[model samples]
Target: MSRTELLRLVFAQIFLHATMTGLRLAAPLLALSKGYSAGAVGALIALFALSQIFLAIPAGKYADHHGVRRPMGFAVLAAAVALVLATAFPTIPVLCLGAMLTGAAAGITVIVLQRHIGRAATSNAQRKQFFSWLAIAPAISNFIGPFGAGLIIDHAGQASGDLLAYRICFAVLAVLPLLTWLLVMRVRELPFEPYDPKAAPTHAWDLLKSANFRYILFVNWLQSASWDIHSFLVPILGYERGLSASTIGTILGAFALAAALIRMALPVIAARYSEKRVIAASCIITVGVFAIYPMVSHAAEMVVCAIVLGASLGCVQPMVMSLLTQVTPAHRQGEALGIRLMFINASSFLMPMVAGSFGALIGVGAVFWVVASIVAVGTPVVGKIQLRDNEMPPEKNL
Candidate 1:
C-alpha cells in the first residue's frame, strides 16, 4: 500500500472506531443514569458484539464481493443512524439498538479494511507492516473515543451531572461516521480477477479443513483469551488486594499503551523476525506474565507486569492477520478474516463470563495460574501453523 493510501485508511479507521468506542462509553453511563442495574449494563455492553459475532462471516463474504467502499458506506450509515437514534431517544432500549448497530457497523468496517489491505499487499513483509500499522487503530481509539466522550459527558451539561451530557456525546459521535466517509470513500479498490462460482468452496466452515487455518485460529483464540483474562480479572485482583480503582485503571492503561508501543516497533523488526518466531515468543512471554500477575502486590509492580503482558499479546494480531490470508485462498481471504474476527469476538464475548465464574470458584490468583497453564500447553500448537508464505508490511521507514 502507498503511504498516502495507508494514511487515509488509518484516519478512516480511527474515525469509525472512535464513533463506536465513544458511544460504547456513553451508552452504559446513560443507562446507569436511567436506573439500570449492573447486570442490565452488562447486557447493554454485550449488545456491542451481537452483530459482530453472528454477521462477521456474511460481512466478510460481502466485502470479498463488493470491496471496501460499498461495505464501508453501509457501515458509516449504520453507525450514524445508531448514534442519531441514541441521541434523540436516550432510553435504555434505544441505547441497546445504538450499541448493536454501531458495533455491527464497526465490525463490518474492520472486515473490509483488512481485506482491502491484504488483497492489495505485494509481499508477506508488506502485509505484516501494513497490519502492524493497522493494529494500533484499536489501541489509539480505545483511548480517544472514551477519553473524548468522557470529557463531553462531564462538561456538556450546565452542571457536572446531567442526562443531557450523554445526549450531546451521542450527537458528537453521530458525526464521526461522516468523517469516516470522507476519508475512505475515494480510495481505489484493487483490480480483482472475477470470482468463479463453481470453484468456490461449498461452505465457509470448509476452511477448517485446512490444518493451517485451524492452528492459526487456535493460536489466535488463545492470545485473544489471554487479553480477556487481563481485562476481566485485574479489577478483581486489584480490589481483593485493596488497590484503588484509579490504580487498576492505570495498570490496564499501561497494558494498552504497551500494546500500542510494541506495534510501532513491529514494522522495523518485520524483516528480522518470522511470524512464527514472533508468535511463539509472544505466547511464551504471555505465559510468563500470567504467572507473574498474581504475585504482584505494589501498584508499580502490577503496572510493570501489565505492560509486559500487553507487549506480549500485542505481537499476535498482525502476525495472525498475515497468516490468515496466507493459509486461505485468495477469493476466500475476506471469509477467512471474517471467520477469524467472528471467532475472536465470540471468544471475547464468552471468555469474560468464563473468567468470572473461574474467579469466583478458584480465586483470582489460581485463575491466573490455570489460564497460564492452559497457554503453556497450547504454546506448542502455534508452531504447528504452516503457511504458504510470509506476509507483513514493507520495512520502509515505518
Candidate 2:
C-alpha cells in the first residue's frame, strides 16, 4: 500500500471507532432519558456485550473465509444502518436493537483490523507500531465520543422538546462506516494457504489443551472482565457517590484520556521489554487498582485510581495480540484469533450480568471487590506464558 493509503486507512479507522464509541457511551443515557428504569438501561447496555459472546468467532471465521475487507465492510455498514435506525425511531426496543447490531459489527471490525494489520506491516517494528496505533484509535474515540455525545444531548435537551441531540449523534455515527468501507477497499489482500476440506474444525477445547494457549485466552478473558467492570460500574458508582452528571462525565473522559496516552506509549514499552513482561506487569497493576478502588471515597482519589487503571489495562490487549500471533501456526492464525476473541467476548457478556447482580444486591460498590479478585487471579497465570524460541518469528528477535 502507498503511504497515503496507509494514512487514509488510519484516519478511516479513527472515524469508525469514534462513532462506535459514541453510540456505546450514549446508549445508557439515551435509555435513561427515554424513561427506562436503571435495570432496563443496564440490560440495553449489556445487550452490546452479550451479542459478542457468540458473534465473535463467527465473525472471525467469516473474515477468514472471505477476505477481511468484505466482513470489515459489512460490519461498518451494519453499524451505520443500526445507528441510523435508532435515530429515526428512538424507542427502547429499537435502541436495544441498535446497540446489539453495533456490538456485533464492532466485534467483526476488531478481527478484520487485526487480520489486515497482521498482513499489511512488513516488519516486527512496523507491526508493533501498527498495533499501538490500533490501540490509540479506540482510546481517542472513547474519550471524544462520549464527551461529544454529552454536549450534544445537554444542549438539545435544553433547546428542544425532542432528544434530538443524541439522534444527531447517531446520525453522524451512521456516516463513519462508509468511510471505513471505502478505505478498506484499497487494502491489498494478504496471502493465505487454503483450509483443507477434510480437516476437522478447531475446537476451543483443543485450543485450550495447550497450557500456554489457555493462559493466553485466560489473560484475554480477565482483561475483558476488568474492562467490563469499570465501564459498566463506574457510572453507577458515580451516581451513588452523588456526583453531578457532568462531573461523572468528566471523570470518565479523564479515564479514557489516560487509556489513550498509555496506548500511545505501548510501542515504546514493547520495544524495550518482551510483550509477556508487559502483560504480567500490567496485570499486577490492574490487581492493585481494582482492589483499592472500592475503598476510595473522593472523586480526586477515584480519578488518580482511574489513571493507573487506564495505564495498566490499556497495554494488555495489544500485547496479548502480539503474543498470540507468535504462538499459533501461520496457517491457523485466523481461527486461533477467532477462538481468543470469543473468550474475550464471552467474558464481556457474562461479567456485566455477574457484576450487575453484585451491584444490585450488595450495592454498586461491591463490584470493585468482585472485579479485583478476577484480575488478581490472573497475575500468576500471566507469568506462565512462554514464547518458545521456535515459535518466535525471526524478525521479532532483532
Which candidate ranks first by lDDT, i.e. highest? 1
lDDT (Cα, tens digit) per residue for candidate 2, span 1-398:
45676566666677777676778778888777767899788678778766777777776666666766778778887788898898898777787888888877877777777766755666555666677767777676666767777777777768864578778777877887888888788777777655567967755345555667778888878877887789778888888888888877777767777887888888798677777788888888887888887787788888888888877888888877776666665545566677877777677767777888888888776678766777787678878887663244332222
The TM-score of predicted model 1 comes to: 0.95
Deviating ranges (above 4 Å) for candidate 2: 1-6, 25-30, 121-125, 151-167, 193-205, 232-250, 356-377, 389-398
Candidate 2 at 73: error in angstroms? 2.2
Give the C-alpha lDDT of model 1: 0.87
Q: What is the C-alpha RMSD of each candidate to the true structure, in Å?
A: 4.1, 4.0
Instruction: State the TM-score for model 2.
Output: 0.85
Note the clash tally of each candidate. Answer: 13, 0
> What do the candidate models score in CA lDDT, each in turn?
0.87, 0.74
Winning candidate number (TM-score): 1
- After aligning candidate 2 to the native by TM-score, how far in Å is the CA of 88 from where it should be? 3.7
The digit string of per-residue lDDT tens for model 1 on 304-365 reads 99999999899889899888877777767778888998998899899999999988888999
